[model samples]
Target chain A: MASKLGIIAGGGEFPGLVIAACRADGRPFHVLGLTGHADPKIIGDAPADWIRLGEAGTGFKLLKEAGVAEIVMIGPVRRPTLKELAPDWRTTKFFARVGLKALGDDGLLRAVAKEIESEGFTVVGIDSVLADCLAVAGPYGGLVPDDQAQSDILRAWEVAKGIGALDVGQAVVVQQGIVLGVEAVEGTDSLIRRCAELKREGPGGVLVKVRKPGQDRRLDLPTIGLATLREAAAAGLRGIVVQAGGALVLGREAIGAEADRLGLFVLGREDAC
Target chain B: MASKLGIIAGGGEFPGLVIAACRADGRPFHVLGLTGHADPKIIGDAPADWIRLGEAGTGFKLLKEAGVAEIVMIGPVRRPTLKELAPDWRTTKFFARVGLKALGDDGLLRAVAKEIESEGFTVVGIDSVLADCLAVAGPYGGLVPDDQAQSDILRAWEVAKGIGALDVGQAVVVQQGIVLGVEAVEGTDSLIRRCAELKREGPGGVLVKVRKPGQDRRLDLPTIGLATLREAAAAGLRGIVVQAGGALVLGREAIGAEADRLGLFVLGREDAC
Candidate 1:
């Protein structure tokens, strides 16, 4: 018998995809739907245990009852404010143990993954389950980048890396030779939207993404998908680039199809930025 | 006799303020307004000579004819594209001589200043004549930044300096401990506008601007004015901070008035960022 898998679902289609992948593989799984964050339709029909954020004690019990042997944390989870934490016994204890390291973004996540592991549930990266989701090197679309677009991508990559070293952001938009936008609190889609309004008249810009230098890939891996392609196309961008194998390309085939249809380029950079 | 002053008008109200200042002093002045830029009303009302950008030959001739001994370049000039340059023999020769060094923003401006000086007109810093236009140390609106806003400004100051080292931008917005937005090709007003949309629930963010580490002070000194106060207030920002005497404060009285009326703080940082 396949051991039941436990899923912690957040926003976006990622959780939904996880369910389908588990079902196709004949693996039974129970999802802990984070209230107000996970998609309503996806959590509504699934065998999900509704859990509020900051209720980790309750969440652990649900996973135990479901007899889950492994866990996957997937999708976009908006970081809550201090007041929003409203920690009960579990999350309060969780924070106490993490202590000062919780101040840094990566530090807190690392502690969370460590705390979950201490609870005896193996925390696995989503990519391990959905192997094909990792984007490959080279352009996904039939189209190739023009010289100017390629140059912009390279320029953006350099700037993005510098910002990453600061650990502030992962995406930047560059056109011709100048940077138009750098994503900080704003995510990639919004950054692309802002870039659209700022692009010069002659040609569109390039959206480039790379992992924050030395970032743990297991958590918060950079992702681009069909929606990314759609948004970039709508933004009148020439192309998109992400570090190959270091980022997730959700729905790769569909994204490639969309890219080709839109005459946009989706390039996967081969090495660390 | 008062030395004849030549005003090279760029794009913003700074040029207009200079003209008014000169008029008030009964200082004879001639304005060489860049054709596509500069406020039409202000330039039109003055003894102005119109010359397109890159037509430096005509500009030098006009200054000589006006008997101007020193010149002050003011206002916000959008950097022109290659095609827009359509370089007349003067600018074409200027770039050729500046050569590879003209690639960086500061380098190009420095070369331009040097080129103009070589033509025998002493290039004067705008601050030299408009000393009253410089923002002083301390708050203009009689309000101190609260603890949160103060911390955000300090945090933003650090990040802005890092970006400055890359010669990318000079301003950054920070709320809480996170950077909300960064300025690149997009100017301060737009960055503030973007920050307005990205700021989370809480007190608003702080805008921190400083001269880039090695930037030529005379060429593109950071600036703020009444419109800045209005827009920042409209965007729900708590305050703004800049390097004391290192940045131009156009229409200081009007900015102070608007800042006080809107309950926003305008600060001048004492230390180098």
Candidate 2:
């Protein structure tokens, strides 16, 4: 029998997807939902504990008492300030140990994962939990990218990688050889929405997402869902390109259908650097 | 006496500043203002020829007829589409010659400068004509950066240079070691304004601007003026940092006074990479 799982849920649909997957597999689990981040509706009727983001001690105690042996942290959480975070004793200790403020988002995640492991929980990656959710090589739907989009894909790939190497961002928008924007702390969705207004009067732009160089696979990998496709289409983007096997695609079928309906191509390339 | 200068004016106060400099020095010059870009008010009563941006052949002809022996291109023009440009026969020939669409903004500017030189006119950098406009090392006003602001400046400098190497952008906003935004096609002012919404709860961000690696100095170098200072202040940024001797600082005294009044530092760093 699969060990009881602990889900450390942040904002977005990924946590709900994981919960459904567990239910289908008959794997027992408990959720520790982050307040102000995770959707309370998603946790309805589930075995769960709710706590503020800075309440590390409470979260760990709740998971342990619930008899969880395995843990999976999922979804997006904007970086909060120290004032906003209001770290408790355990979180303060964790920050002291990790030098939290000096690290980027990925760095922070790696540290959190390490601390979770140190507490006797076997931390697992989302890819390992939901292997089917990983993006595959080539178009997700029936649409294929044309030469202009391919060129943009290649251009954005290099730029995204360049920024990623600096631990800056994982996504970029390019149109007709011009970079419309690069993702930073505001996240990919905001980046897309911002780039929409800056779009040139030519062929629409392409959104490219990739894993940061040397980034921990278990934490904060580039993720896109149906919402991403809809936003891209609404933002006048022609297509989406993500690194195959390096990013996540939640609700693939729905996303594929949505992409087709919006006339936006969703391609997964294996050539991301 | 200075050679009769040919000013290829785009949009912004840089053209006006250049024109003011010319009048102050009693230098004979003619302005070739781009129709959709330059301010008609700035070009008022000046020996100027108003033409569309795509009328390169006519521009050259007018300059030659006005006895222009030296040329300077200044100001920021949003990248326009070929359709929006409505390229005349000369621009079409120039694009065919230079592979225009394949180049970034700086690359296109270099090609234009080279073409102007080939047309028998000397292309001068803004630095050469307006030497006083060049940014000097250290603070521009009474305010000095705090340690945290200093750290943010260093972080944004590396990022700005990293993006610059990709020919992507010249500016980035960093707050508490997190990058808020990076400038792309939307320009520095837009980048600052966008980052304002993304500003974290702690100390404000710092705007770092640098010259692109291997970039031709004769073309677009990073430039900041009174408006830049106002926008950065309004965006809740702690300060602005520019590459010492590598960027233009227009209206220095007014900017310095404004910086002091707004409680923002405008530092020029000498060690930008």
Interface RMSD of each: 2.7, 1.8
Where in model 1 is the C-alpha error above 4 Å? A1-3, A93-106, B96-106, B251-254
Q: For each candidate, report its DockQ versus the true two-chain complex.
A: 0.45, 0.73
Score every model by TM-score.
0.91, 0.97
Evaluated on chain A only, model 2 obtains a TM-score of 0.97
lDDT of 1 by residue, A185-267 (tens): 78899999888877776677889998888877777778888889889999999899999877888888898899999889998
| Best candidate, lDDT | 2
How big is the positional error of residue B271 in model 2, measured in Å on the Cα after superposition?
2.6
* Winner by TM-score: 2
How well docked is model 2, in DockQ terms? 0.73
Question: Candidate 2 lDDT, tens digit per residue, A77-177?
Answer: 87888788898999999999888664545688888999999999999999877878888998888898898888888889999999999889999999988
Docking class of 1: acceptable
